[model samples]
Target: MADNLLELDTPVIAILRAPTAARFAEVTAVLQESGITAVEFTLTSEGALDALRDCADFAYPIGVGTVRTAEDANRAVDAGAAYLITPVVSDEVIHEGYRLSIPVISGAFTPTEIHRAWVAGSTMIKVFPASLGGPDYLRALRAPLPDIPLVPTGGVTHDAAKAYLDAGATALGIGSPLIGDACTGGDLNALRDRALALREELK
Candidate 1:
């Protein structure tokens, strides 16, 4: 992790992953209006790099997720991504993000993997598929790894946001539960509603 890691202004990192980024601008705008400042543009989404570049002047921090390769990390950095996120603990990806002076939110599940990722220099450990073990699982992990910041991702619903935070999550990575069909051209008003509700829940 770099000394200048992207600050998490909000607890939720809104994940926008769809077939394409055609709705990115609209979705992001609604999220911002709703007070959700952190966004993750997953490379798994088509045209994500170009979309990220298009948001060069976006008001908030937008990171690139699902980055598994160094080349992808470089491309994302070039595209103006504020940070990087990986699905698993990949030292290559972590090192590339470090070299680029970008923070990497490395994903891990087990306690060992979590510690390994932190040792590998990830800015934060994303407890992927967090729904599998839920908040109690996070609480257990925090018992021993109190110093490491954790961000629970995957199936993070608005209703469960506070529970995760209370379980020691530094932040959250919310996808479909918060996004719904917004990124796929669903209703922006509905997206705003969800964002607002989620933000309020966190508060």
Candidate 2:
């Protein structure tokens, strides 16, 4: 199993949230088959911690998202999470990640928040709800803060992925647009099709 995020070649982070994480393995297998390896399991899901411990042997980076507190961060790390992702800028979470030596993708919306997160030692700044500003906003942010790696999450569609990358997004945090009910007893085939389509779009 791979433990390092640096080994991830694809710049796409699949954000998975569901009623239960029992179907996580099945869904992750489909994504892996489609060439999207990086996956984030949000704590809001049922049995997510157990799933993280269960998927420790997976051969790709598996991260924990929606992390808000230091206790959750520690718990995730103890459960073998390769990285931690937050929905907002939390100094405690970022410091915990730094202490644990795990990467933290801190979420932020405005330029001030982004810079603050970067300076606070966030591994990457997740420009959340990126649909609001779109690629042009990313371009504007990159103009001054070119060195900060940005991952745009929330409402990133397959067709718009390339535009985000073109706008200087280091990676994308995609959810429903890619997962598409796969974890909720929806068609696995449909999920695969979407994943394949996303791969093609990225290429």
Candidate 3:
């Protein structure tokens, strides 16, 4: 795989933010069983990069999230992260993704912020805290910037996943909603079930 996240027909990035690296494998397995191909292991976890490397052999895109600096971006690229995801728009990090030819999903909410992230070379613009505005917010943003690949991440749930997509989201960046407390309780089956439901809903 060339590790391009944008190539997927159903672009759903399963944001896995577990407390322990031990659970990463199980969660990843469940997601894969449910046909989830794009995943992001947040940097907050102690062994996120290690988890990413371990899953590098999987036939899907695994990326690093919550990236705030160019150094972290560079490190993630070196660690074999297929893409980079950020909660905020950072010029340095976005530029680094461009230089590395790794897709970057930089987060922003407002028109100005979204546009800035796009111009900074982010492969996709993530609308962080999107729940605050809901799918309607994305609809408004799309009015003017119809070409930007807006990814509405954070606070997105399966019940509302289709609406966001209908509102113009290129993809959905889902976290706890899909993984749930499975990471904490080690419920791989629960995560798998949710992933299946989500996949069906998106259809």
- TM-score against truth, every candidate: 0.96, 0.95, 0.95
Instruction: Itemize residue pairs with steric clashes in candidate 3.
Output: none
**Segments of candidate 3 deviating more than 4 angstroms:** 1-4
Cα lDDT of model 1 by residue, 162-182, tens digit: 999999999999999999999
For candidate 2, give the lDDT of residue 149. Answer: 88
The model with the greatest TM-score is 1
User: Per-residue CA lDDT of candidate 3, range 1-203, in tens?
Assistant: 23356555566888888766657767887798788878888989878888878887776667899999999999898888888999998999988988988889998999999999998888899999999999999999999999999889989988899999999998899999888887677577778788888888788
Q: Write one digit per residue (lDDT tens) for candidate 2, span 1-203.
A: 22244335667899999989988888888898889998999999999889888877777758999999999999999988888999999999999999988999999999999999999999888999999999999999999999998999998998889999999998899999999899989999999999988888787
lDDT value for candidate 3?
0.86
Task: Please list the Cα RMSD from the true structure of every candidate, rounded to 1 decimal place.
Answer: 1.6, 1.9, 1.6
lDDT for model 1, on a 0 to 1 scale? 0.89
Better of 1 and 3 by TM-score: 1
lDDT of each: 0.89, 0.89, 0.86
